[model samples]
Target: MAHIGPAYGSLAANQAKISAKRDPALDQEVQTWIETIIGEKFPNGSYEDALKDGVILCKLMNKLQPNSIPKYATSGGSFKLRENIALFQTAARAYGLEDAELFQSVDLFEKRNIPQVTQCLFALGRHAQRHHFNGPILGPKMSEANMREFTEEQLNAAKNALPLLNEGMNKGANQSGQNFGLTRHI
Candidate 1:
């Protein structure tokens, strides 16, 4: 008879593997961290208010990463530069947004506006849920070689921050004022 390895695909085996790795207490701690961060950032519980701070936050991000945004070349003498600026002005006028708002949004997109801790946590939670994890996975995997795992303390902090994240996400959804059917689903 030939010897065979244990069946890694069996339910019992999988359960044992998961049990060895999963730490429910640590999971709860991480959730607590997430909630705490959110509460501290938004004592009054308003994500819209946080978004209103984005312009200043984006400016700070720009300072940290200079020239990360595409500029209209205001001082350039080239015809193409003038054309681009005129086009940008026309688009801004059409959208009823100031040029600064447009630039700020671009900066926010590039930098992810991480200074808004609640929003950042919400995004991380969403991403983790999408990937079927209680929290973001940080470590090397055979499938995802570059995946990074958070330290135990970091995970606990994120857990404590979850409530604020949930509040911010919910507030943002409601503030959008567009019926995306989230109310019915949630």
Candidate 2:
């Protein structure tokens, strides 16, 4: 039998390149959290959509399911849903959703009157039990135990829950692509 050394070397090189292109596990973890929060709270929305919204579901959702995205707060002092919605739309565009109709669904709330949107986010948070996000993006010191209280469980919960959330997002995105011909443009 002929030795296929060059062919095997090329295959190995290709595999290495593919592995290098894979998304960082940590980023995937965060993405998972975003998806989980979106699903339980904003069932109709996407992970890309919820992440861009910036509702911070981890702290907001603590009583719901592991995969719930808490609904946004509705009290007078709570964050404005319209602004967050716009932010989320912007983020979604950045995350491979450029020119997608994903933002169209949120336009109605852009005119203000976002109580429903807020409520939906809060509910998602509640279901997901997200309590705190302490990462480089939000700044490491933001979650300092001295300035604030944080149980190891909460931190670990977020960490462990991430992969599952990402799985959900993958499934959701796959379904969307199957149902609506959506493609990853970015």
Candidate 3:
């Protein structure tokens, strides 16, 4: 059962689902992080409203990496505000944050997906440690590579018999003895 609506309807539904799953605690953490980094308080009560214009984001990026955003329009139209977000995203990517950790400008400017905005902020906070910036950390610390070296004998032994993984499943079960529905007639 479905409606013959336009293709964009599904996108709206997805946005609604994401918007519904927003966690207030995460939002508050993101807000605190941005404000602490930028040294400016959020103008609005909620994090989304405070960052919709993208100004604080630019400030955050700059604080993380000085002059990352050379120019972020503080007073302008929608296009200029959107540009600020784009600049922040580019700078964030350059700072080692993956594309998946960044959010689209439309997500914040148009308010289409607030959860993504928060997620992006959290990722930024988590990724900030990479720059060695002397600031408060957010979320779990990004783990470092723990390389392990093995001897040739150990490698050969592992190839010969993977004792740990070779342990086959001994827990057995069969439904042949039990009848779920009506019995078959011969």
Candidate 4:
């Protein structure tokens, strides 16, 4: 056998083998970590559902990494990548993960800027979405009407109260006065 240097053709073969073994292990770790986060976030949630959320969380996190959070219009309107985190966290907590590890990882004081927390949450949410863990969490939709007129404190209160109120939408919730698009009425 000939000695293959770094530039040699063997490098591709070696790299492939390494990646093959590493990918699965990395995915397992991600799965476990997501499970832990989801478990803490949604203590009453079923194991199966939590597992699904975990996978989606991983996908969302990946999107957040390297600066790629989706810009699709959300309940909060046209928010940037960072603000998307806050929106996601607000929704996540509403879905029953108030003490989610994703929030715990952020340090309010250390991070300083509000964007930091938002970005972190966005990243985490992105990761969650990537693995097909995310789905429609049953809860009252935060309409743009309220989001625009409400103060930050008021919005926070609503986000906080969402988990307590109910899971999923309220069939009778009115949307005539909704400030954003019809879809954003949620």
The lDDT per prediction is: 0.39, 0.40, 0.81, 0.41
Q: Which candidate tops lDDT?
A: 3
lDDT of 3 by residue, 39-129 (tens): 8789856678789888888888899899988988998887888888888889998988899888887777766678888888778877887
lDDT by residue (tens digit), candidate 4, 25-89: 43344445544544534345432233322234433433334223233332332223235445445
TM-score list, all predictions: 0.18, 0.22, 0.81, 0.21
Off by over 4 Å in 1: 1-9, 40-186
Q: Which parts of model 4 are misplaced by more than 4 Å?
A: 1-28, 31-79, 100-186
lDDT of 4: 0.41
Stretches of candidate 2 exceeding 4 Å from the true structure? 1-79, 105-186
Instruction: Write candidate 2's Cα lDDT for 1-186 as tens digits.
Output: 123344357777765664454444443445455455334444345343444344643322322223233344433322364454554444434333335334343423321223323333333333223233331121121222357778999888877765755666566455545557556777
Give the deviation of candidate 2 from the true structure as CA RMSD: 25.5
* Candidates 1 and 3 compared by lDDT, better number: 3
TM match of model 1 to true structure: 0.18
The TM-score obtained by model 2 is 0.22
Model 4 TM-score is 0.21
By TM-score, the best candidate is 3
